[model samples]
Target: MSGLNLKALRKAFGPTEIISGVDLEIADGELIVFVGPSGCGKSTLLRLIAGLESVSAGEILIGGRDVTRVDPARRGVAMVFQSYALFPHMTVRQNMGFGMRVNRVPKAEAAERLQKAAALLQLTELLDRKPAQLSGGQRQRVAIGRAIVRDPQVFLFDEPLSNLDAELRVQMRAELAALHARLGATMIYVTHDQVEAMTLADRIVVLRAGRVEQVGAPLHLYDDPDNLFVAGFLGSPRMNFLTAEVQPDGQLRPLGLDVDLPSPIAGLRPGRRVVIGCRPEHVEIGDGPLAATVKTVEQLGNSTFVHADCAGTPIAAELQERWGTRADAALRLALPTEKTQLFDAETGLRIRQ
Candidate 1:
């Protein structure tokens, strides 16, 4: 078991900074996910932790030892990539045991670890199959089993599920979670998909450009994002942003429609430009305040999404039960006052609580 502590971690490509001063503590046996949009440095940070890339600054401590400059093989960390880097000619068993064999570990001991890992990944029956013979999901399992056989202090997964189909990705996600529970080893997963980050991570690190935006439990980040970027980035279907102004009585006027705000902000001057943010699920269709016209309708059996234009403001609503929804239909929406989030229009900063 191992816990990782990062202090002022920074990475740069020449003069361009990639990871700007990130500090985080990953608990032993915890599964942490790093998520962000493209060019957000999520994968680069993972590589830095794996010793696959050099750190421009800051320290990386694993199990109380600073391994910032440690060799990849000496870091006691193993990684699984999105593309399974399996030897085409080697059978599953050989691929899983190759590292141990190269390290000159006894054949019996190597086989023992392989057997245990294969069992955990449910790849025991496919041990004799080559990469060409196994399915994508099976190949991924072999890749993970390879890492497990190493008995590393930490496991790093860099978008390992991105290459799988939607159905297989979901299946593999559950498998990875179960695998983590069985082993209780430190894990760091990096992905662009917020669904994966939300479901699999014990804690999430949301990054943008080079700096860490926020780090917390999945729900915490979703419920209380530090800035507009995080508030919009964490949810499915994404959060809706509406033009709003802070009123004289400390209320939010969304699209000229009055709505109450829970957190006190009386100091905000009247007509102060602010961005009103709320999730799709928080939007309710009713004969009230905000006005929009339905532009498209998406029916997903379990839930229906209504894409509407709120007086030129595009709004998407996720409904548990779709009773009345039509394309190009005019609709009025009531904004949830207490559940609302406000961001400064100029700086995109969340108005101080």
Candidate 2:
């Protein structure tokens, strides 16, 4: 296994920069994920590390060696792309061993590596089948097996599960996590899916508009975001935001609510505009400060989501039990002081105490 590092990594097309200066250190055997919305430079950054794109400026290092200008093949990294990219005519065995064959690895060694990778990926029984005969998940596994046989120092996955169906995607996700644990190899994954990043990554690098926003463990970034952009992006239903005005006593009056709550941050001058953020799960629905009218109720078997309007501001709350709730129902919300987050209205930055 090998560690990877990027120093002031940048890329540009003509005068428009796609990747700003980024510096990150990925530890050996760590599964690091680059997550962001589309066109946010996540894929560009991954391609830069794979040596598929030339860096406009900055350095790329792998296993303590400067590989900024190294050829993709010599950089000791293997990439599994969004598409399976398998040869339809080639059997699973041939597709997995193709790179080894091209590199002129001895026949026995190539065969051994292919067998081991097949067994590890649970593709041993499908070796003789062509891509046409395989399921979407099986084809994806074949692509991953191809990378595994290369014995790369680092593995790069570019939305490798995006093509699978919903249920299959979940299954492949679990398989990928198990594969990472078994190999213990350095990996950098790129995906717009927050759920995939949260489940697979040892650490997540959140990016936006070609710049790094925040980097942390999944729950760390979720529970304590640095900015409003991050706070709203990582959650499933997303966090709820309400406009508020700060009072002299470090209290905030939410625009639609009657009661004032203590500000989670300190030192805000009176009348400063701020945003109050509460996650869907944290917005308790029994009885509290805020009053709302339920607009919709989503029953998800095990749990329910109450979508309500607090005067004009919309909010959602998750309940563990089925409420048999209906639209136009009256409800009260409890925004826990300890669970609330404060952000600058104009700058969209978190206000830390």
Top TM-score prediction, candidate number: 2
lDDT by residue for model 1 over 163-282, one digit each (tens)?
999999999999989889989899999999999999999999999997888999999999988889999899988889987777677777666444544323557778788888889998
Clashing pairs for predicted structure model 1, backbone only? 292-309, 292-310
Alpha carbon lDDT at 185, candidate 2: 92
Instruction: Please report how far candidate 1 places residue 85 from its true position, in Å.
Output: 0.3
Count of backbone collisions within predicted model 1 = 2
State which candidate has the highest lDDT: 2
Stretches > 4 Å off in candidate 1: 255-265
Cα shift from native, residue 197, model 1 (Å) = 0.6
Q: What is the model-wide C-alpha lDDT for candidate 2?
A: 0.94
**TM-score of model 1 relative to the true fold?**
0.95
